[model samples]
Target: MAETILALEGATKRFGGVPAVRAMDLTVERGTITGFLGPNGAGKTTSLRMSLGIILPDEGRARLFGKAPNARTLDRVGFLPEERGIYKKMVAEDAVTFFGRLKGMPAGKARQRAGEMLERVGLGDARKKKIKEMSKGMAQKVQIAAALVHDPEFIILDEPFSGLDPVNQKVLESMIRAENQAGKTILFSTHVMEHAERLCDRIVLIAKGRKVFDGTVNEALGTVPRRVLIETGEGPDAAPVLAAHGAVTDDGMTGEGTHRYTLDLAPGSDAQDALKALVDAGVRLARFEPVRAHLHEAFVHLVESAEREPA
Candidate 1:
């Protein structure tokens, strides 16, 4: 069995008599990338803080490496909080080296690793530049380098992708995959689903201070019905054939003499069977493909469903 790196059992926290995170349970396996996902104000940060022992949980337990969080355990962990902070007056390399030293590294070794990490993150040219002199994206990369310089066994990041442009986001994604390949366990929180979809081996979803879903990506997508996009030359005639299998939404006839329809496959309906049925009906198919359910769709559905449930 794989080792459990982090575990939260019935973990709960509140601020000023209001629950920030309620009875949350989560476990991250070693060498896996786990995404702690939820929208803003969904208790993701609260839960993470509790797990890190930054804030004491009001109930239940939070454990790191089979023991309660402490300085020794934390030394083996690297964290990038949701709120970004660095010494604005400090040079980029100095800032990273400082973080490493705080995690108990000697100054010379910390500075050496800082240089290597900066180069890896594409900030080699900016190493001697002050944090205030760098652009937002460049500064963000510096902060990430700081978190990773120590090469901790487990890395936790809270909303690391926020405020980054598409290009920088992709850069960070590559960095994350590199870390995982190095055999470090990673857990990150994000409101954006695309990052989790692409990076997470497992996902934990929370909403309204509670966990709504926790499972593999494929399992989460399985909660919603499957859909297929089909384009055929049979125009209106294609409607009846698709409707016979499942609810069909007309995407309208294209200018190229092709009719498009989106079919929400009914329970027990297979995409292959639907395609075969269309072909059997003599519909000249131009395109037939499954529309895979995305993490965003699954998240929204789960949150909305939880909201509708009785107290």
Candidate 2:
């Protein structure tokens, strides 16, 4: 219910009948970091284009701050596309400053800000060198500076970590967190779920041009069945007996008198049934508890569910 910073209503795009995005609808609230995640070929780039006003949706609409993709709205947003570009011959500092000037920042002020940002991003030493002379990580730092130099209210980054090494990745992650804390809205698209898990306040997942899931990590994972790992007495393949009323993953005895079994909760499954099952299986049950799935497990469960849906 927070004020919407970006909204797409029934937005659709196509590359000659092969739909890139199909009737997708999503909203990003002001000052929130919302993640866009998907596997390869999931239409992440096309959705980003509509969000940034580069290409109008062939069907439906995209709005930024209640206005159609126009100069005013565009000026208020920073974009780092999946495919990045920088003048290879231009020094890193000059290139970023030039982009700021195009956005109406005065040249002198732009240069000052460029210098500050380079230092902040740890590329101050390479600021005077041509982009082609720098390593991929160094060049990427310059590109991020260019995207953020204008200090736009909303930032959209597409695959910003593709070329970054681990050290650079950590550096960029810190920068992103700092900016978010400063109250800038961010919509970052990545194939990497771990990044989203670490950085986003909320998440929107798309697959094959359709939305498969949208919400917080906790909310997304809430649908998975709660599980329990129990180590008890002894039983020879207790799966069928225990699973008769629920779901069972495995069963085995550890040490003497210690039996371990993985239980999958059935719909309306009574957990007490687990202890009873083990007790009746001639195993003296010793442990009982539910284990919640991790973020990776939840993500796999959701995506697998989405794959079963009809196109």
Candidate 3:
């Protein structure tokens, strides 16, 4: 069995009599890239803070590497907070080196790693530039470099892609893949589903401060019903025929006098079967294509379902 890197049992937190997170259980296995995903204000940050022992949970407990988090254990972890900050006047390399030193790296080695990290993050030219002199995206990368310079075994990133442009986001994604390939366990929180879909080996989804789903990408995607798109020449008989195969909904018109409808295939039903049924019924087909489920769709489905449950 894979070792557990981080675990939370019945973790809960609240502020001003309002719950921020409630009875959450999560685990990240060693050597895997885990994605902590949710919308804004979904208690993701609170949960992460609790996991790192930066903030104590009001109830339950968090175990880091099978023990409570402390200076010794925390030293082996790298964290990039949702709120980014650094010495505005410190040069980029010096800023990264400062964080490395904080993590107990020797001064000379810290400086050396700082330079290498800055260069790896595409900020080598900006190494001599002060944080105040850099753009928002550039400064964010500097903080990322700092978090990673010490080469910690476990990495936790919260909202790491929030401010970057597409190009820089891609750069960060590449860095994450490279780190995991180098045998680091990673957990990152993001509202962007595409990033999680592309990078995570497993995903934990939170909504309204509670976990809604935890599983592999394929398992999550399975929550969304199988669907297919079918277009037929505005015929009254088509809707009835389509409904026999699965739940049918009218999609907006595609072209002149052509209507599009989404058919959610029933359990034990197949798209090919639906297509054949439509053909057998002599429905004039304009288009017939299977609709693939996506992580974003699954996220919405799970979250919305959770929201409707009694609190």
**Which number leads on lDDT?**
3
Among these predictions, the greatest TM-score belongs to 3
lDDT of 1 by residue, 96-118 (tens): 99999999999999999999999
Better of 2 and 3 by lDDT: 3
The global C-alpha lDDT for each of the candidates, from Candidate 1 onward, is 0.92, 0.85, 0.93
Q: In candidate 3, what residue range of length 10 has the lowest lDDT sum? A: 233-242
In model 3, state the lDDT of residue 23.
97
lDDT of 2 by residue, 197-216 (tens): 88888999888898888899
Per-residue alpha-carbon lDDT of candidate 3 for residues 80-193, written as tens digits (9 for 90 to 100)? 998897999999999999999999999999999999999998999889999999999999999999999899999999999988999999999999999999999999999999
Residue 100, candidate 1: how far off, in angstroms?
1.2
TM-score of each: 0.92, 0.89, 0.97
Error of 1 at 45 (Å): 0.8
- Ten contiguous residues with the weakest lDDT in model 2: 232-241
